[model samples]
Target chain A: MALVLQTVDLQKRFGGIVATNDVSLSIEKGARHALIGPNGAGKTTVINLLTGVLRPTGGRILLEGEDITDLEAHKRVHLGIARTFQINQLFPDLTPLETIGLAVSERLGMGGQWWRLVGSKSAVVEQAVEVLDRFHLADVMHERTATLPYGKQRLVEIALAIACRPNVLLLDEPAAGVPEAERHDILAAVAALPKDVTVLLIEHDMDLVFSFADRISVLVNGELFVEGAPEDVARDPRVKAVYLGEEADA
Target chain B: MMAAEESGDASRTLVAQANAALAARARWSPLEIAFWLAAAASIFLFPTKHLILTEIAILGLFALSLDLLLGYAGIVSLGHAAFFGFGAYAAGLLAKYHVVNEPVLALLASGIATMLLGFVTSFLVLRGSDLTRLMVTLGVALVLREIANRLEITGGADGLQGIVMDPILGRFSFDIYGHVAYVYSLIMLFALFLVARRIVNSPFGLSLRSLKGNPLRAAAIGIHVNGRLVAIYTIAAGYAGIAGALLTQTTQFASLSVLDFERSADVLLILIIGGTGYLYGGLIGAVLFKLMQDWLANLTPQYWQFWIGLILVIIVLVGRDRITRTTDPIRALVQRATDRVWSGVRGSG
Candidate 1:
């Protein structure tokens, strides 16, 4: 399989504090890869670096074999990379459909035309509705996204990422604030993404990770601990001592 | 998952095509179109004195320039009057010393001169937040006023005089009827409005709106937010300069008070009364504010400011949005009645 993305010795330091340290990883095309780590292990930082939100103190990132380390986040998005935040980053006043439609327009490289009520454009609105529907958000298409429940908000955020039509999607803790009852639904929706779309997911729940991810990379104290198939990683003694100890209690 | 993906892709494609079609058919918003039409009609239709119409047109253009920066670009400036005053002085000096004979050259000189000044100060203004930006703009205006006062060439407090604006387009000299001045101002106002409208409707304008809503998100989406803001701010300064030049040419004088805080305050008040982000709001607000002041001052000379102050207080107390919604309740009722009558006629036909 062709590798879609690779990070080479990525490092980020805030004075003496190392947020990310010599981290290197590769994502195969169309594969569901998981990045698992404890708190402060820099999972979100990694996402930021990949999406161009934060610059690395050292190292390089390659998308389709072209280095994009110096690219701005939005430019990276146009290059077929998109991400969702751990916290919902949405236009609070806009409808979910409108939010998605704006993303679609950006992805398609349309001029602003914002004052022109492009919201009524059937193709754009239809695309927005389709993404919403995939996440079961049709009824709330016209409703302000801020009014949606936490779980639904997460789904809408995901829909926005999908609206970009990026070749690689980075999901930062899709189930972070989700209620237990709605957690399964979130996992199932993410697991259902198109096979051609590569996903790099940062999830805390071992159950969701093991069931959904094809491969898992463990991180401890800003360093790579181990990486392998879920079953082997689960059985690894070091993994048990660190990640599994917390999982057993959950 | 497969079913959801299929539906999502299909709907996305459908929405894109539908949006493109709808966008193609959409016209300018009712508020904007109605405003310009009404303004144009009133200019030709109203029985006001010619000089007053001239003042209205000049003031309207000035307010519109401020609106471009504050309303559309989200740059809250309190010193825009400095550019206006600078343009007036520049044009007046040019005309006073026989530096330029043609009105068009004076106008271009005024605009380009202030634009260069704006470009120099834009870096300082662009680095600050709203409050800081306001202060920087106000500071610049203050400095310009002081400089004008100090310079003998600018005529100190006596103002720049002997500004005989040569015949516009080499015809229709400004006369006692104020016909040429009024018509010239009106045409320039209309032209500026068209350019402002075009700029605000373009991709660049949309980027401004996005930046206003969320700068971080805009940057994340690949926008060079700071560069765009600086460029727009400078463009707005150029508009302000032209407005100043128009006033000086039409009136044949440039006063130090043009750069005064009162001028800036009036522009801000006009924007507030009319609404922000709507191009025509500036014109409507200027006309209404000026009319109110003109009428009120004549009625109660000593208490004119007091009455106006009270009106502003009432507006703020009642809340701008709510008061705006209620401003034309009576007119709205009349409109509804007229609509029903028209529909009844059509139905009978």
Candidate 2:
């Protein structure tokens, strides 16, 4: 697989603390990559650095072999980088359809047209409906996203990110706070995404990580401890000693 | 298997219906048409009310501009009247010096000048939170007021004088009855209201609303948050400047009162009274505020302010949701009637 995203010694320091220290990562095209570690292992910090939410102390980020370290967050998004937050960051007052519609319209560069009604754009609305259908959110498409159940809101968040039609997507804990019974919805949604889009999933659920990730990278204390196939990482003593521990089977 | 297929078909139908409903919601409702018609008819119904009506139009435009910032863009400005007063002075000075005697031309010039000022100051407003923005905007207004008070060109504290506007379009002179002023201001208000209506209904408006809901998510979704704010702020300033120019042309004078703290506070109160987020809130609020001022001030000439304050307190205590809730049934009733009529037309055709 060709490399779609690369980080070169990404470093982030908050005062005396090194939040992200000398981390390097690469995501291949069509790769279902997972980043897992113990608590405060800088999993989210690295995702933030990739999404341009936090500036790296000293490093370079390359998207499709082009340097993008200096780009702003929205500019990064325009460059086909999309992310979902650990916490649902959504417009509570807008319905799922409206939210998704906005993303689609923005992707199409029609987000700035002030003279025409957004609904009148049938192509955009159709695309939004299609995206909503993929997430199984068609039934509650008109209901305000905030009023939806927590699991469903997470699904909507992913739906929104995918609506951007991104080439590289960083999902930060998509299944966080979701109940067990509803976790399958998120799992199914992730599994259904197009294969050509590169996905980097940050997760704490070991079962989900093991099952979904083609490749797993273990991080300990803001540094990559090991990276390999899920099975190899699962059995590796170094990953178990520092992070996975004896819970590898469970 | 049969049940699953049926449910799938039902959901598809539901999605289609929901999309249609969303589109319908953006169109002009019967209530909006009725309200505008009644407003337009009022010009002829109460000929003696021209002066007050003209005042409402000007004040309505001013409130609408603030709504675009505070309601849609989530930018709370405490000194919007700074632009209003500046435009008033710009128009006043131009006409007083015979620099631009044409009313429309003067209005445009003044509006552009104030828009430039807003563009310059938008950077400062964008740098802070709500409280910080309030202080900065208020400080700017205060500074401008003091400058106006000290400057000889602004006639210092005495205000600009000896200003005369050429007949509107060189055809109709502004009369004491305010006939031309009323028509002129109403025309300007309607034209600008159409522009505002178009903007708020468009994708740009939706993006602004998203920003207002959550700036972080807006940016995460590829919206340049600060850029949208600055653009709306500049456009809003132009609208407000035109409103101020209307007042200056109608009254043939620009007074220091235009820049007063009370002016900004009053417009804010008017917007809240009418509600926000919707463009009509300003127009409705201006009508209610000016009419209440007219009635209450006469009833209690000494303490009208107390009554206005009491009303605001009641509005707050009652809550905006409850107020709208009470009217929901009536609105639904009207909606049903309109739907019936529309279906009848479709069926007959």
Q: Which candidate is the best by TM-score?
A: 2
Query: What local lDDT score does residue B266 receive in model 1, on the 0 to 100 scale?
Result: 86
Which candidate's lDDT is highest?
Answer: 2
What is candidate 1's TM-score against the reference? 0.80
lDDT of 2 by residue, B221-247 (tens): 888888888889998999988999899
lDDT of 1 by residue, A1-250 (tens): 9999999999999899998899999899999999998877888899999988899999999999999999877789888888888887776655676567667666666634533445544555666667777777776766776788878888887777877787898988888898887777766776777898999999887778888899989888888889999889888999778865666766
Q: Evaluate residue A128 in candidate 2 and report its C-alpha lDDT on the 0 to 100 scale.
A: 88
Candidate 2 displacement at residue A49 in angstroms: 1.9
Worst 10 residues of 2 chain B by lDDT: B18-27
Stretches > 4 Å off in candidate 1: A1-4, A13-18, A57-67, A93-98, A112-156, A175-196, A220-223, A240-250, B1-34, B44-48, B93-109, B112-121, B146-158, B299-307, B324-349
TM-score evaluated only on chain B, model 2: 0.92
